[model samples]
Target: MTALGLLYPGHSAEDDYPRIEQLLGSDIRVDVVHTDIGEDAHRVDALKEMGSPERLAAGVEQLRLTGAESVVWACTSGSFVYGWEGAHDQVRALARTAGMPASSTSFAFVHAAAELGVRRVAVGATYPDDVADLFASFLGAGGVEVVSVRGSGVITAAEVGEWTEEDVLTLARQADTPTAEALLLPDTALHTAALIPTLEKELSKPVLTANQVTVWEALRLTDRRVNAPALGALFTREPIVQV
Candidate 1:
């Protein structure tokens, strides 16, 4: 069985990984190790500390026991808050510590968008506008365009986790724009594993949520792909070929 390690920030939606593992069937295993979350605030300083090398290193030690072939920092705000370049450096450090292919949910969204050949996307962010703006900038650096962004201004991961399915759908609808090719829900704290197909159907477009993209990114690093349509458009079609 292939094993993917997820270094999640806190107690929010870490459970989504296991749900993904089940959806992918028994051939894959998703192990989650929660890292130190000093302050759950969505501010830049708190987020940077949340994704610090020291904390990631500690999480990697636990994942090593799981024999995870790849690792992903399963927090979007935590990584994107560091900006594009810094996020790259963060995963590089994680890879070194884990001795495995490593990435973060922020990069996951970027790569997932590229795989689907989606350039313009609308963001349904759970962060404050300032923090949400940083995520848009991070996506910009990856060559993805943000057609629009809707921030909930939620202060903590705990609050985002408390959001219900209807709340998620409402955000997707509000954030979607006619110009956007897809809608992105960029908070790992939010529970979305079961709402991907519903969200995509309701919006009539691709819906890329944090936990969904996080699993997809881990599969990409392992050079493996599983056809799980329930995961939504990201998993329903073949990867777009780049010339």
Candidate 2:
């Protein structure tokens, strides 16, 4: 069986991961490995503390034990707060420690955008404007253009994690525009994996959410892909032909 490891930071809306696992069914499994987080709030200094290189390295060994072929650092803020190059080093550390393919949620958004041929994109985030801006920068560094970004000013993932599907849909409409090829919701704090299809329908453009892209990137690293339309348009891409 194919398995992708998700190295989750504690401050995430974790329910989203299992939902993806269930939707993907038994042929593939998403194994979640966690790192320490001191508090659930989104203070920059505090978040930085949660994702130290040592903690990330610890999680990699755990995921390797669980038989995960590839791993994603599953928190957006947890990685992006480190800046673009910093996030790259974070994943390199994970791969170096685990001896497997590795990536982070911030990079996942970049990879997902490339999959859909999206360059200029709008962002909707659960973080305060300052925190959210860093993500837009991360995307820009990775060669995806950031058309615009609207932050919800949410102080905690605990709060965003509780948002109803209606709330996510509303954010999609508010964050998207005709100029952008797609909308990016950048927070694992928000439960968005199940809402991807509806968000795409409402905007008539692809929606890339944190956990959704994290899972997609993890699968891609494992040299596997799924064609589940129910999960969202991202899954409907033509499977990568192995060399």
Instruction: Give the whole-model CA lDDT for all candidates, comma-separated.
Output: 0.92, 0.85
What is the per-residue lDDT of model 1 for residues 56-155, given as tens digits with 9 covering 90 to 100?
Answer: 8988889999999999999898899888889999999999999999999999999999999999999999899999999999999999999999999899
TM-score to true structure, per model: 0.99, 0.94
Q: For residues 1-243, could you state the per-residue lDDT of candidate 2 as single tens digits?
A: 998898887744888888998888788989898788667767788777777788888777778888988888888888888898888888898788889999988899988888878879999888889988888888999999999999998997778878988898888888888999999998887888878888888898888888899999999898787887877878887633434
Model 1: residues >4 Å from true position, as ranges? none
The candidate that wins on lDDT is 1
Off by over 4 Å in 2: 239-243
The number of clashing residue pairs in each candidate reads: 0, 0
Instruction: Compute the lDDT for candidate 2.
Output: 0.85
- In model 1, pairs of residues that clash are none
